[model samples]
Target chain A: MDIFNKMFGKNNVSSKTVAKERLRLVLVHDRANVSPQLLETLKEELIKVISKYTEIDNSALEVSINNSEHSVVLVANIPIRVRRSMNTVC
Target chain B: MGEVIVVTSGKGGVGKTTTTANLGTALATLGYKVVLVDTDIGLRNLDVVMGLENRIVYDIVDVVEGVCKIKQALIKDKRYGSLYLLPAAQTKDKTAINSEQMKQLCGELKKDFDYVLIDCPAGIEQGFKNAIAGADKAIIVATPEVSSVRDADRIIGLLEAAEMDSPKLVINRLRPDMVKRGDMMDIDDMIEILAIDLLGVVPEDETIVISTNRGEPAVTDKNSKAGEAYRNIARRITGENVPLMNLTIENGFFQKLKKLIGLRDS
Candidate 1:
C-alpha cells in the first residue's frame, strides 16, 4: 500500500483522501483514549508474547481503534509466518 | 418535560450559537415554546443573535446566584413570543456556575418550554461541561476542514462520556462547488469520519451572516437556504422526517430529461 501510494501519489491523492487517512489514524487512537506511546507498549507486549511461539511480522503489525457508527472497536492485525512448533502447539 | 439539546463544537466559530438561535426560532415558529440558553459564559452571543440582547436584565449567573428568578432572567424574544433567552453573564467566568446548577435550571425550565436549546462554549472545558450538564442529547457543529472535524470528534467523545446519548452532527458552511470539484470535504465524508448520524447540513449562505448581524436568526428569512436547512432540522427534532436538502448546483429540467434519456453522462 505504501508503494502503491508512492507510485501515483501526485494525481491520485485527493485532499479528501488525505483528510480521511489523517482522521482515521487520529480517531482510532482517540476512541480508545489510549496514547500513541501506550499503543506502542501494547504492541511490544503482544509481539513478545506471540513471537515466543511463532515468527510474527512485526513490520506488518497494525494495532489501532476503530469507531463504527455505534461502537468503538479495538483492532489488531498481526501476520504469522508459520504454525508454531509442536512444543508450543501441544 | 422538554428535551434539552446542547449545541457544541470543540472548535470555535463553527456556528453553535447560530444553530441554537435558528433551531429555537424554528421550533417556536412551529408553535412550541422554546428557550435558548447562552452557556458560553463571559462571551455570550446567543442573546445577541436572537435579537434579545438589549432586553437582558439578569442572566444565567444571576439565576444561579439567587440574584433573580429564572423566569425574570428569561427574556422574551423580539419576534417569537413563545421563544425566550437565558443569557449568560458577560462579566462572569466559567467558574461562576457549575453543572449541578445548570441541571437544576434546566429542570425548572423543562416544565414550561417545549424545547431548551443550550449554546455551548467552544472547547472541552468548564463552559462546555456546564452547558451539557443538563442535556439529554447533543448536537455537534463542525465545518468541512480537518481541524474543525477533529475537534468535533473530541467533543463527541466527551458527550458520550457525560452519558448523553447518540449525539447528532450538523455540518455547517459546506461549499457545494468545492465539494463537486473534490476540493473540500463532502457531507458524506464528514459523516464517515465522525461516525455519527447527520442531523442536517447548512450550506454557506450569506443570509446567515446578514441575519446574525441584524441580531435575528436566519430561519425566519425564507429565502436563505441555510435558514431552510435549520427549519428542517427543528422539525426533525420534533419527530418530523425531513429530507436533507441538496445544496449542489441545480440541473435544469432539460438537463434532467437528457440524463434520463441517457444522452448525457451523470
Candidate 2:
C-alpha cells in the first residue's frame, strides 16, 4: 500500500493531510529563516550542551525549533536511561 | 463617495487577485458601482483573471503619466455593467507608479464609483506600500497553512504601522474535514492567532480553478460553495448581516450509528 493508504486508509488525500505537511515545513523555515543545514548544526550544538550536564540517549533525543504564533520555541526532548552500575556509583 | 479597500497578502499565490476580482463582481451585482484595480505591475494577472486583458487599451500607467485620462483606462465589465477594471501596465515596473500617484488615482476613482478595490502584489516592498495608500479599509487574505498565516500576520503589522484601520481577515481554502480530524487549525485558532475581525471563510473548491480558467469568477455561480462565501463577504462589506456558510462535513453512517448507540449528540 502507498503511504497515503497506510496512513489514511483508501480515501483520497484530504486537505487536512496537505495542510499538515505544508505547515510542518513552513513553520520550520519561518521560525529562524534557517535552512535544514543550519538546523542540523544547531541540533549538534544542542547535543553538545546537554552532554556536558548528564548522560543522555542522544540517538533518541529530538532537538528542534518550533514556530508558535507569538514566538519561536526551542524544543529539546531528551531521554535518560539509568544503568544499574551507574546508579550504584551515584 | 466610494470606500477604497485594498486586498493584500504578503505571500504569493494565496488568491489575492481572485478575491479582488470576485468581490468587485459581487459588489457590482449588488447594485454598487465597483472598479477593480490591478496593482501588480510588470506581472499583471488581474486583467487576465477578470477576463479584461484583451479589452484594455490603456492602463494605470497611462493615466498616471497623463498619456490617457482615467476614464479611458477603465474597462467596463459586460456582465455587470457597473463593474470596471483599471488594468496594470505589464511593460512597466512597479517603480513606474509610486504611492503618491496611487493615492491620487484612488482619490479620483472614489468620485465615480461606489467601491474601488485595489489588488495588491505579494511581498512587503514598494509595490505593497503603493497598493495600501489612500485606501480606507483593507482585507487580508490568507490560506490555512502556516506560511500563509505567518505572512498575513506580518502584513497586518505593516498595515497597523501605516495607521490603517483594523483590516478584516478572509480565511481562504479551508477544509472542514481537516479541522474535524485535528489535522488542521480551526477557525477559532486562526482568529486567536491573528486577532482580527473575521470577514468570511471560503472552502477549497475545485470550481474556483475552473471558473478562474474560464475568466469567470466563482462568486457568480450560485452552485459553487466558494461563490456563496464570496457573496456573503460582499454583503458584509455593505453593512449587511449574513450568516457564515456551513462548511462542515456530514457525519458518516457508521459514526451516526455509533453515536446513536452511545446516546451522544455531536
Interface RMSD of each: 1.0, 4.3
lDDT of 1 by residue, B7-55 (tens): 9999999999999999999999999999989998889888778877778
Best model number under lDDT: 1
Which lDDT value does model 1 have at B157? 84
Q: Cα lDDT for residue B211, model 1?
A: 99
Best by TM-score: 1
List model 2 lDDT by residue over B1-266, tens digit each. 99999999899999999999999999999999999999999999998888887898999999999999999999999898699999999999999999999999999999999999999999999899999997999999999877788899788888998999999999998887667755577788678667899999998888899989999999889999999999999999999999998988788787667655654323
> How far off is residue B15 in model 1, in Å?
0.6
Top model number, DockQ: 1
Compared with the true structure, what per-residue lDDT tens digits does model 2 show for residues A1-89?
25534565756665556655665656456545666777688778877988887788878887677776867777778887667776544
Clashing pairs in 2: none
Cα displacement (Å) at residue B72, model 1: 1.3
